[model samples]
Target: MRNLLMKVNYDGTCYDGFQTQPKGNTIQDRLEQAILHLTGETTKITASGRTDAGVHAYGQPFNFTTSSQIPLERWCLALNARLPQDIVVTEAREVPLSFHSRRGAKRKTYRYTINGNRFPDPFQRRWQHHHPVQLDIPAMQQGLTHLIGTHDFTSFASRRSTKTSHVRTIFEAHMEIDRSMCRPSSTDQGVIYTYVTGSGFLQHMVRIIMGTLIHVGEGKLQADEVAEILAACDRAAAGPTAMSQGLALMSVEYEESWE
Candidate 1:
């Protein structure tokens, strides 16, 4: 059995999500079908994590076992040839049979984009969450500091998660504006990104965290209030769930230490 690991990047605008569904229009379904077409092999692909519907991915890793003799370098090209334009296999490599995409993951970094501008950009409407008012950046940054260490992120995850442990170590968390430009008549604001890296995240964790930070920015909650929210372990105490389109699985890390 030849084990292959792939780096996948997708727009995630039109599909249900990364996981396979009965309807067969997801990222996994498209990848599997493309692989089958390229190598005539049927195999299951496992991702580092599942992004919610309309959530994008930059360097999501997935693995599968195949007996096909395709060259590793050509796998990306071959798979992309059969897949939709929105989904692309960025890189492919041979890995040990012992490696599992999800199991081998040490940490994952997520990025959530917010359009903090007065006017919405039609071109970026599907890629970011548009907020029409100026946000209190300092308040949101103060809130992010509370999440940098280990804690039970119960308040941030979906209540539907039945996991035995809600505790995850957050290696880093921060929010910053990517870029800002002033024009003669208008401003060209790029976007604000909330970045979080952790050992693992429960379902909807990052999105909920973003929501809470947005609330902090809006002055609805203070920065220190995040600590209380985590301690409460009550999902209802958290802020609203942010839009899925603003969230992206930026990358999966397998290094021993992210610190």
Candidate 2:
């Protein structure tokens, strides 16, 4: 059997999440169904990580073992033809049998967009989180300083997570404004956009961080409080978890050693 790695992009608005679930449709379920239709193989595919409902992805990676002789380019086109419009296989290539998508990943980056304005735009409603309150960018940046580097992110994770370890290394975390892309009439004219990159993230980690920073932007929480939350190691100490729609899995990185 030959192993193939595929890069997939999907709008997470309609589906449940990335992982397959018994009660609802998922990105994995649809992709696997398409694969079965094309190759008649019931083999399961492995993804780099699981993204929650309403959380989109740009370059999510997955691998599956298949005996079919279809060429790499056909895999992308054929899968896109059978899959729903929201999900698409952007690229596909053969890989060594030992190249596991999840195990081989070096780092993953996630981006969260917030529409900080009084009114929401019709077009960006599905992809961006809308908040009416004006945020203080400088204060938000001050809070971000506390999130950079390594720390126990237990306080930022959801209470429902089954992860044994709460400690994760964050390579970078900061907020900035995307003025060029903001709509002319958007309340987000001077709104700030938050971008974060890290080796990996805990469940609800990015959202919680965003929520906490929002508090800072609103002047409800002191910028230094972020450090206190991390030191507390309590979920309740962090800010409320932000909406999942604003979060996107930007990309997953695999080390050269894996190649």
- Score every model by TM-score: 0.94, 0.95
Poorest 10 consecutive residues by lDDT, candidate 2: 182-191
Query: 1-259, model 2: which lDDT tens digit per residue?
Result: 9999999999999989999998989999999999999999997999999999999999899999999999887899999999999998998989899899998887888989887766776887888898877787888899999988889899999999898998888887777676765557756554456778887888899999999998998999999999999999999998999999999998888985433
Worst 10 residues of 1 by lDDT: 181-190
Q: In lDDT terms, how accurate is model 1?
A: 0.87
Tens digits of per-residue lDDT, candidate 1, 80-103, equal 899999998888888888888898
Compared with the true structure, model 1 gives a TM-score of 0.94
Q: Which pairs clash in model 1?
A: none
Global Cα RMSD, each model = 2.2, 1.9
lDDT of each: 0.87, 0.88
Model 1 residue runs over 4 Å out of place are 181-190, 256-259
